[model samples]
Target: MTKRAKNTPRWTAGMACGLAIGIGLGIVLDNIVLGIALALCLGVALAYALPSKDTQA
Candidate 1:
């Protein structure tokens, strides 16, 4: 029997959430540049905060 590896998501929920919130806030505040900046910062932060699994076992 062959075992299949689990697939990891390219974008985590936290990253997506951060991006959505950033864009929404930027739009409401009427600044597209701010939205992009916020999205980049928040997405990086959120993505970095996530726990990564070690592939080497």
Candidate 2:
């Protein structure tokens, strides 16, 4: 298995997901830009707030 980088934070996946959600929300809400921005911030925040899923042995 690939090892995670020591200094890198696992925010990419979270951010991507947030962005995707934001895009959809924006489309539905008629505010793509705001949706993306808000979602991105929330996503990054959640990424930091949540515990890592992978554990090192």
Candidate 3:
């Protein structure tokens, strides 16, 4: 199996997901601050929760 490079950047997807959820919540709830805060927390949580491909071996 091919191993992932150790230094591969993985934050993009988390950031994008966070931004989408934040924007959606912000628009729906009419609370930009709450949405942003939630997004930031979620993105950080997700980033840490996700495992890098290198560890799959």
Q: Pick the candidate with the highest lDDT.
A: 1
What is candidate 1's lDDT per residue for 1-57, written digit by digit as tens?
A: 899755443357657977898999899999989998998788877765654564325
The full ranking of all candidates by lDDT, starting with the best, is: 1, 3, 2
Clashes of each: 0, 0, 0
Higher-ranked by lDDT: 2 or 3: 3
Per-model TM against the reference:
0.61, 0.59, 0.67
Give the top-scoring candidate (TM-score): 3
Ranking by TM-score: 3, 1, 2
lDDT (10s digit) by residue, model 3, range 1-57: 997656443576776777788778987999999899888877766665666666667
lDDT of 3 at 5: 54
Structure candidate 3, residue pairs in collision: none
Please tell me which model should have the higher TM-score, number 1 or number 3: 3
